[model samples]
Every structure is written in structure tokens, then in C-alpha cells.
Target: MSVDVRWLGHSTVTVDVRTPGGSLRVVTDPVLRPGLAHLRRRPATPDPAAWAGCDLALVSHLHHDHLDLPSLRRMRPTVLVTPPGSSDWVRWRLRRPATHVVEVAVGQTRELPTPCGPVQVTALPAHHAGHRTGSGFSRAPRGAEAVEHLLRVPGAFPGRDLDDLLLWAIGDTGEFAGSDAVLAAAGRAPDVALVPVGGWGHTLGPHHLDPRQAAELVARVRPGVSVPVHWGTLHPVALGATMGDRFVEPGRRFVREASRLGVAGAVQLPVGGSLSV
Candidate 1:
């Protein structure tokens, strides 16, 4: 079964997972609107409305951009999955009765039942802390660690030995030692890897992975296909003039790094584009 992946912007993507059991559509960290605070989406979203709605949403962390309440509301995924310690915050912050919210801690795997079938979701450790603190905003729950989600498809199908396709969303994270071991716990390599190669601001902290680091990780993971994300998207409104090639450079650099590393199937997908693997 082939997987269909669509890049909305930043770390947000819609993956249509099809397996023998059934088909499920999942969105990641949706920021569907035109702008997030002062950071405006560049190149413009072809159709923000197209990213709305999903069977499930995989919120990797509590960062404002990654776990936007308004965006989630717009998308209206039947279920919202976030890291541990943030579920309560999300429910309260959303200002609604979000009873379907679930928390998945690092190294924990849970099977979520969808209309089609159950899908296995695993929380993998990331090097960043998932705390949301800013002016005029409630601080996110303490001890909320950032995470990467491994979405394994077609879970727990009887007699068929399902869970064939694995889509790994390597959310915002810095390169850490022995991260491969954490990824190996998925029991199999990812079929399609979504790697973050850039950021919204001018400089990236140690908590984020740059273009080169993303390429290096992909080479190690050796996924069937790799697509660059978190770049060529949003940027601070004030720094828009100063951000010359910053939005597009990371993607080009990632492609170059992947080629240099001899990593095949590295794709540079534009915003509002889809990749099938």
C-alpha cells in the first residue's frame, strides 16, 4: 500500500495512509491559517482550506506553531494526539470539551482506533523541550518533552499481520547521540520520513535540526523516501526583508547534502505539494 503525503506548511502535513485493513488520513501540527502571530507564511498557501479536517492529528509538541489551538479547531480532526502533560492544556486552551484528546509519552506506543482501522502511534524522544511560554499566553504544562511521532499504519488487523507502512514525522529536534536507537524501537525503518530542515526565525537553536543535520539523519535512517519540511514557509514579518534566501536555502542545501551523502529518494516538495511513496 502506497502512502500519500501532502505538505501544507512548516511541520504540518496530511498523510493519507492506505493499507489492507483500510485507509486513514492524518494531519500533523496544523497551522492552516495565513499567519501565526507575527510570522507570516511565505510563498502563500495555495489553499489553506484544503488542509482542513483529518481522521487524526499528531501534535509533536506544545510549541505555539506546532500545536496551535485555532488551527486544530479549523482542521477538526476527530482525535488530537499530543505529548504527555499537554493534553489537559490543549483541552482547556481550546476552550471546549475536547474529550478525544490523548497524550503519548516518549517511548510509549498506543493503538488508536479510526473509522477505517486501528493505527499504531509511537512517541519517540526528541532533543527539545516542549514548553509554551510567551506574552499573554498560558504556560504549557511542566515536564512536557518534545517528541517525534512514528505513525504505523493498519494496526491490529486479525490474521493479516497488518501495519505495513510506517510514516515517521521527525518533528522539531536537534541532532542527538544514539537517536537511531530510539528510532529503531519502531521495529522497522520508516517507509517515508518527514525531516525538518529549517526554522521560522533567523537562527535555529540546538533544539532544532538544520538542513545538513537533517540530511545526515536521513542517511542514517535510510528511509524509502525523504521529504524536507519546516523550511520555505513562515518567517518573522519584521525580518522578511532580511530573510534573503533563508526560506528557500535550507531546502536546496538539504538536497545537496543528501546527494553528497549518497542518500537516494530525497525530495524537495513545495508548499501545497504532495508526494506519494
Candidate 2:
């Protein structure tokens, strides 16, 4: 089987899985807007209409950038998958009429029916927080050891009602367990893995993977093809061309590291670029 993968920007990726019957398109984290809060999307905003035929949309977390309400409003995916306990928020946030939303947790798998065939989607563990605050600054925390510790504790934000509604963690044995479950549930390595290599910040915090770490993940997942994403799309407006390199560097670094790690079929594509694998 071969799939055409497109890097739309940030955590958004569109995959066209071709089969003997027909084609099925799956989109992950559809954030098609130009600007959000202090972060301004870089050039080449993808056409929103590109998402019209998406059969399945997967949202990794509740962060505004990944689950932008405005962006989701424009999309018309047949089914939307979000982390467990996120259906209510997703429904409330969306401006348009309701779309079919499915809540999935780590290790849970869903089979999406398409004209081509049945495509299995397993919700794998991600080492990132799922908390979302109205203020963007609250979501982008800095520091190293301290932040890492806080992120490891799922739903660390005490007394915050929203945090209580979602599960988030990293640097924990449970994350590994969930990953193992996903692999076992699939019964084989996935055809393509969309891994987040970096974020829109000067330095990566806990629960997030840099280039080297992302490559390590690819080695573990052992997918037929691994594509590096979550980079080269958005940046802080205040930094303004000073740290412009951060946007593109992570993806490039991940490609080099994936090659060094001997991951089979590691591929990197520019934003708005597509590759058939």
C-alpha cells in the first residue's frame, strides 16, 4: 500500500491512502488559519478547501494551535477523533453545525469506513500536555527540569476544571505502556507515522520531542515511512525574523537524525509539499 502525505503546517498533515477500491484521505490536527494570539503563521497558508474531502480528522490534543475552532469550523471531515473527554469542548467551540465526533484514548483503536476500504486508526500516546488556557502564554511554558516534572503528572494543573477533563503526560512509564498497546493493537507497524518534532518556541519543554528525540521515536515505531512534522509553520510575533530559523530547522534536523538512526523510509517534505510513499 502507498500513501500520499502532505505537510500543511504545525501539527496538521493530510494523508491520502490509496487502495484497490478507491482513495481515503485522513487529516491530523487541521489548523488552517493564518494567525492566533501572539503567534503568526508563516507564509503559504494552505487553502482551507483542501480539507473538504477528509474522511477522518484526528486531533492530538486540546491546545488552541492544534485544535483551532475557526479552522475546524471550515473543515467537513466525515468523522473527528479527539482525546477522551474532549467531545463536549469540541462541540461547544465549533461554530458550524455539529460533525460526528468520536472520543478516543490512548491504546483505543477505531476503524473508519471509506469507499476504498476500512482504515484502522489507533490513538497512540503522545508525550505532550493536553491542557488549553484562553491565554496563549499559559500554554507555552519554558524551563527544563521543573517543567518536565510538571508535565509528567497528567492533569498537573490543580484546581483547573478544564485540566481535570483531559489526560496529559510525558516522561512516564504509562506513556510507554500506551505506545506498546497501540503497536500490539495494530498487529503490524503502521504504514506512515506523523511525529511531532518541535513546537513554536525558542526551546522545547517537557513532553515535546526535538529532532533527535523524534528520530528515536521513529526507530521505536518502525513505521513503513516516518514523516517529521510540527515545525516550520508558526512563530512568535515578538521574535519577528530574529529566530526565524527555528521554524524550519527542526524538520531539517529530524530528517538528518532519522537517517542517522537507520529508520526505514524516513521522509521530510516542505510545508504545503506532498510525497507519495
Candidate 3:
């Protein structure tokens, strides 16, 4: 089977995993350059026109970078997979009428018909929580007299469809069973695994996996090939001031850790780079 994977910079990737009949195109976190905070100053920019034509787009979480609305709207994929509450916000932004958005919960799966074959999307557990900041009353006023709407749980969403396709862990801050979803999805071994190797800045957040952690994950999943993402593209607000010197360490750590693990599966590609499997 021939599989094709492209690094769209950061956590975004266009994966063409070969199925028995044809090819399944999967995209992870498609981010455009302009709206993003750090990438704007680059001498050159990624040509959005060249981005992969994806069959499905996966919004790993609710973060601005991961679930970038502009980029998602641009891709306009037929199917969008994301954590609960994501569809509603995305739909509101799109203003293209109610769209076919699938909300997934951890440990569930959904299968969609595709040209190559049926592509299955699975929701893996994430330890990190999603939040939306708000202030002032909107058109609807909060009830002072009566009980108000209960605050929705951070991770709640519609039912999940954890089916045939491999696992896609949205994002996590800590080491938990939910964090282990990648291992479960791989199920002993996977043809290829796309893992988060960096966070928003030089410092690794408690919620995301840095390159070293990603290397640890690669060892556990034991995939035939491991591709690192989520780094080198965006710098944190604090680090952005001095990003010139901070971006390369995570990737280098990933490589070093992989070497130490004696795991020959690690493969690194340049930004907007691609590799055939």
C-alpha cells in the first residue's frame, strides 16, 4: 500500500493513507498563515492555494491555532471532526447555513464514505479541557429571577463514532488513560502515527506533548513510521519576542529521543514537506 503524508507546518498534516481500493485523504489542523499570531512575520508565507485537498479535516481541539476558523472555512471540507461544541461555533462563523459537522466524544468512532474507501474517525480521550471566555449579556439576558442554564461541561459533545481509521488524540495536558488513546488506536502497531511534538511556544505546556514526550509516545505506539507536528510554526506570546532562538529545540529533542529509544520509525519533514509511504 502506498501512503502519502505532507507536513503543512505545525500540527497540520495531509495524510494519504492507502486503503485496499484507493487512497484515504486525512488532514490534521489545517492552519493558514495570516490570522495566526507568530507566522505573519516570515519573509515568505505558505501558499494557501497549494494546501492539500483534504477529504476530512480534524480539529484536534478548540484552541485558536488548532481549530482555526479561517483555515477550516477555506478548506471547506465535506466533513469536519472535532470535540463537542466545536460544530456550533464553526457553523456560526461559516454562516453558510447549517453544515454537516460531526461532534465526537472520547472512545467513540464514526465512519464516512470516501472515494478510496470508508474512512473511520475515532475520538480519543484528552486530559486537557476546552474553554471559551465570555463577558456581558448577549441578545438573551441572563435570568435574575429564574435559574439560569447550567454551565456545559468542558468536554461534552454529541455521541462519538470510533471506527476503523486510526486514533486521533485531540490534545492533552497530562498523562492519563485518555492520553493513552494513541496507544489504543495504534493497537500494538500502526502503519504511521502523527503525534504532537511541540506546543504554542518554547516552553512545553502541561496539556500538550513536547518533542521528548512525543518520542515517548512513538515508542509506545510502535508505529512503522512516526511523524512529528505542532511545533516550529507558532511561537508563544512570551516566546514570540525571542522566537528566533527558541524554535528548533523541540524537533531536535524528538530526533534525539527517537534515537535513544532505538526506534527507527521516526521521520522528520520540513515545513510544507511531504513523504510517500
Candidate 4:
């Protein structure tokens, strides 16, 4: 069996796995539209229609860029998987039926049947904080009230911290007992792991991975092939020149760090580029 991994800019990746039974395609964190708020998509905007046949769509978190409603509508995946406590928001925003949405928490697994076989998806824990955008209060509070609120509240005002899932896709598998079985089998490493190494900013935020961190993940996951996504796609519109530099530099940094960490088979793919393994 072989799988074709395509980087469609940002965290959007389409993995086409071929098995004796048939073929299945899985996409992650698709943001197809251009010029989202203060950010503008760099050159080579991905075609929304190219993702038409996606059997499964995996959303890592609820950030606007990662879980864009407009982009999700364009893909219209058969099944959408998100972290726990996010199904309600997705359903409400997408206006899709509740049945189409599936929420998987950390250490949980969801199996999807395809013509080739059953593709087992295991949700692993990620380091980043997965908070929803605009989950805070509408108006800014002043002085002592703000201090008291900050002291009392655990998280942001509205949205709670989400389960930042590092999705592991296992292809050509027959049946699994449960999440535990899947984890044990995953000890052998996945054929392809879609790891997010960077984001749309110059500096990565909390719960996100920089080049060094992503390299460490490569060593830990030990997949047959590692493709670094979520970089060089989107940047702040106001930061001229810096945006262009960020778009191409982070991938190179990840590659260098992976090599330094003695991780083999780390492939830094360009937007719309693909590699088969």
C-alpha cells in the first residue's frame, strides 16, 4: 500500500491512500478562501473544488484560520471530525446536520470504512492551547473588575480550551478493538503523519510548534514519512516583506532542525506539491 500526501497551503493537506479494496482521501484544516480578516493568503491559492472527494475532514482546533466556515462549506466533506466541545459551534456555523459532525477527544479513535478498507483515525494530544476566537467578552471591562475577573476565571470568557489533537491516520487496517488497540498499533508509526510546524504569524503562539519543536515531534512520532505543513501560506497583511520571508523560511528551518535531530525522510513540500510513499 502507498499514500500520496499533498500540501495545499497552510495546514490543509490531502492524503490519498490506496489499498486493495479501494482508495480514500483525508483532508486537514482547510482554509481555501483568500484574505481572511487581517491576513492575506500568499501566492497560489488552492482550488476549493480540488477537495471535492474528501471522505474525511479533520479539524485540529477552532481557531478561525484552522476552522474557517467558508472553507469548510466549500469542501463539503462527507464526514467532519473535530475536537471535543466543538461540534456545537461547527454545526451552528456550518448549518450542517448534527449527524455529519463527530467529536473525538484525546486518546479517542474513530474508524471510517472505505472501499480499500477501514482507515483508523486516532486523536493524539497536542501541546498548543485550542481556544475559540471571539470567545471573550464583547466590551472590555475596566480596572478592579477586570482584575477580579482575571483572577476568578480559568480560561477566556466564552470559549473554553479545546482538545488540540494531533491526528494519526492509519491506512489499510481491518478492525480495531478500540482507542487502546489503535494506540498500540500506532507504536509502529503511521505511514504518513500530518504535523503542523508553524502558523500564519512571524512568531508562533502558545501551544504551537516552532521549527525545533516540530523536529522533536518527528523524532517522537517516527513515521515512515513526515511532511511539514501550516507554514508559508498565510501571513499578516500589514507586515510587508516580512510576510514573504516567513512564507519560505520556516519550512527550511524545520528541515534543518529535523536533519540536526537525526530524523530521516523528512520532506518539506511546497504548496500544491505532493509526495508518494
Top-lDDT candidate index: 1
Q: Which segments of candidate 4 are over 4 A away from where they belong?
A: 136-185
Residue pairs in candidate 4 whose N, alpha carbon or C atoms collide under 3 angstroms = 22-116, 128-207, 232-247
Instruction: List ranges where model 1 is wrong by over 4 Å.
Output: 46-49, 96-99, 155-163
Query: Can you give the TM-score per candidate against the true fold?
Result: 0.92, 0.80, 0.78, 0.79
By TM-score, the better pick of 2 and 4 is 2
Candidate 3 runs further than 4 Å off = 18-20, 37-44, 97-99, 132-173, 236-241
Candidate 1 lDDT over residue span 133-169, tens digit each: 5723576677787899898775422344544667888
Residue-by-residue lDDT tens digits, candidate 3, 1-277: 5556777777677766655555556677677754464444222345664454666677766656666767777777767776665566566665544236776655566666665655566666555545432313221112111000000111111132322334343333444554444555545455566767776554656667777777877676676677777667776444466765445666777878998998886887777788875
Residue 198 of model 3, lDDT score: 74
**Candidate that beats the other on lDDT, 1 or 2, i.e. the better one:** 1
Report how far off residue 127 is in candidate 2 (Å).
2.2
Model 2 RMSD, rounded to 1 decimal: 10.5
lDDT (0 to 1) per candidate:
0.81, 0.63, 0.59, 0.62
Give the clash total for candidate 3: 11
Superposed by TM-score, candidate 3 places the C-alpha of residue 120 at a distance from the truth, in angstroms, of 1.0
lDDT of 1 at 224: 75
The segments of candidate 2 whose C-alpha lies over 4 angstroms from its true place after superposition are 135-181
Candidate 4 C-alpha lDDT tens digits along 1-277: 5557788988788877655456667778778887776788876788665577777787776666777878888787777877666676677778756327776666665666544555555565454446554656312111100000000101111232421112353211111123123235355554455656777876666556677776776676565577887778787887746765677877888889989988887899989999976
For lDDT, candidate 2 versus 4, the one ahead is 2
The whole-model C-alpha lDDT of candidate 2 against the native structure comes to 0.63
